[model samples]
Target: MFGDAADAMGGMGSQEDSLVQIGVLVPLSPPGWAEAGRQLLGGLELGVREVNAAGGIELQLLVRDTAADPRKAEAAVSELAQLGVAAVVGEYHSVAARAAAARADALGLPFLCSSAVLDALTEEPTDLVARIAPAQSHSWRIYADFLLAAGHHRIAVAAQTSVYWAAGTSILRDHLAARGGTVIELNDLTPAALCDELADSRATALLLLTGTPEPAVAIVRSVRRDARLAEVLIGAPAGQPELPAWAALLGQDGAGIPFLRYLPEVFSPLGARVDAALRETMSAEPSFVAFEGYDTITALAEYLRVGSWAAVSVEGTRGQIRFTRTPGVGVWQWAWPPAQVADRDPAAPDRFRVLHTA
Candidate 1:
């Protein structure tokens, strides 16, 4: 209902035989993070190209733009399942991913989630679903530790009231409170008013747990301009800074604000080569979500060949991609991808600096 479906990519020279259809779910339209969706799609398309070229299990991609709507995602899964897709993959938004995961699980379809990491992907554990990104608790705790080490004991979070943000706020608060730190929640305030609350809290750091543009961009601009908040550190553990559009919007103000990223300090050989390819394809630096999408296909191709998630193990652009039942995570998980706390260099907003790694 949001966007027309496209038979985006198909393997060559498979006219006599049917190529396995992989339904790709992503946010390619507004309300969703469209930039993230395109990056992810770039990776997935690249993976599909490479996989087909390898000449074994053929694949065709049926793409649905979720627009970050949970209902759209669930309906997409149902439609895909009926279309006889062997597997479903991709999604950048956590809420949409969760809905898609639940539907896939109920329908007994395998869903390889690319980037959403809300911790509780499904209300109950299921072998039918798996994830490629590290859980929110896993990475956000690392962000929390980075805050503490950077001498930010009193941290504040300006967030929306989503399960994802609430989970992040709780993780930071619990992890920080255990080490004599406190978290302040500044919700529903206008960006200017947010700066006032942030200034009054005397919190050394403000973690942006809100979505991009509207409140997030406005809040960053307000805090950067506020004289009282000159010393307050702006952070986005949810990774607003990872988006290129963010820098284009905020420019210099976007720099030095640390956020979570899921790339290793060193890229694997496959990672290195794919990075170059994606850069050429995208004509810019690809976000980690791209790598996640590439890996999702890499994993799914193996599953398509072997027809078992347990038998799916492959080297992806990031590292060795494998799935296992992880504790606290309700679905099969990659266990983790590499996690880092990074920020754009204030000197050159295009350049990113890796601060902490795990």
Candidate 2:
């Protein structure tokens, strides 16, 4: 009967009769953000391969590119719905995810997000939109904790003024105040002005809340070059992998700064397994974004196979993966930790690990 139902949904062959069709919408051509999107998709593909091999509800992933545009994301969601996909995943950008989630809700299809960390994603939650990564609030809280533990009482925040950064800043400020630390300075800096502001701040630590690595490197270099700010520690969200440029820019000092990452040491074993699989299958290193893709699909596929619609939760490679319905939206929670970077080697600052809450 399950097999028959699967086939009736269309495109399921005899071998695939119990398989679910999952739609993945991503920004394969996001003007300048193409590589990140490609890496995320590669992770998704590896995840699908592993799950199918392990004998679960077979999943046929239908992929579409949203080009990092909100309008394109809506169109992608429509296209996925028309293709009879049971669930939709992706649109890594927060803006794109918000646009896509609305459409997914309208169609009553499950929307799973891997990257979008804007506070708005969970603010007006619905049952149809779920996430497999920590929200921006959680990331910022963790970042604040790291700074507090490092004996830094005064800090500065520099970030883009986007929805993601705004939410992160709110969380950071709240946490910093609670720890008896004052945010002496907060600035909205362009790519160029970010350096000048950092040079002028008297804070001992700088917390950055941005998405990509390029801007982060620029900011780090600015601080490192300033004689007065040499002792100032720098940190950012850990989601940005240690790209080569970041290493070159930070050199040895980058290792001293902490980064907020979600993957906990408790989940290291699981992360290692997934990381190994990703590296083996995709010819690329597995990032937190990739882990998000893996966990979201695994949870969704399990829910489909068991036919349980009740709120389901499971441990993911990085953190907890679960679905819950809110008044206006559905929220997905992933396991994440408030962590700090312990040390940095100029050759491998990107390899910083996390120290979770005890």
Candidate 3:
């Protein structure tokens, strides 16, 4: 389903010149988060353009579509390695990132994973792989804080069965329980069943962690339809708010439901300038994944600017980027991007507000 390494980079201009080649792996097709692929590509291309404009090293993106498949991810990394890319970035799925990161490690290449959030993705120590997004535990902590602040002493948790969701759910449940909070119920169930549990538990809040936006949307829709859950606060941790699907699917129902996202303050001077520039070229509002892609490239370029990749650190739109050894996650180092909780406004369905930062 793929060509040789030479064929993969054949369309790219000669690499023998001053160009610094970087590998871009993203899902660009159906069943592979194609929307996120386009957004990530936009951010990466924009970052590279800005860098070149500022007289930074010339960058050439050797792009590959992971198709959101683990097998394809492995193939993409192998192809990028054979093409001799200096570094890699941008993956939307944890399954794919894990497979691709292993390949990059075996080849001794630098890989900065953008959006995948499984805690185990960076468990072991290796210099080859790093991440711009926080693990499940970190994001869940932000959620726990929000619930605790809201006076939600009794919480009902429901999640998908994937390793990523399970990791996040466990962390969130344990943290909340340890903090004098009570978990009335914690289990995985269908949307309708989850709604029933939410209504029956008499919980102050329902914490829903799912593998994708579709499931989160379903739960929200279920909550909206059930009259019994009228006063129960709904909170979704991790990247649910960053998914374009959420906004499109939830509509007015999204109001009052807080979810974690990584958007910079839109009205702030720097944020306004950057967002405006991005809006000029993008069809959708700039998402957290987009910023992650932009920051990943920018961070890598800063290291390139210093003429070394060894223990390098750089400030980015998300926060800081530096590879520190992490254990029990994977064979790579990790760094967390800054994140915040955001909520849709019922008065303005198209508008959202940042509620808390982490």
TM-score of each: 0.94, 0.83, 0.86
Give per-residue CA lDDT, model 3, range 124-186, as digits (tens).
Answer: 566556777777677778878888997888888776666766677678778988899887655
Candidate that would win on lDDT: 1
lDDT (Cα, tens digit) per residue for candidate 1, span 56-145: 557789999999999999999999988978779999999999999999888877888999999999999876788999999889999999
User: What does candidate 2's lDDT look like per residue over 104-196, in tens digits?
Assistant: 777777777877776577345555566766666656666677678878878887766576666666777788888798775456566456556
Model 1 clash tally, residue pairs: 0
Ranking by lDDT: 1, 3, 2
TM-score winner among the candidates? 1
How good is model 2 by TM-score? 0.83
Q: Model 3 — which ten-residue stretch has the worst lDDT?
A: 1-10
Which 10 residues in a row give candidate 1 its minimum summed lDDT? 1-10
Candidate 2's displacement at residue 356, Å, is: 4.7
**Backbone clashes in model 1, listed as residue pairs:** none
Model 3: number of clashes?
5
Q: How many clashes does the backbone of model 2 have?
A: 11
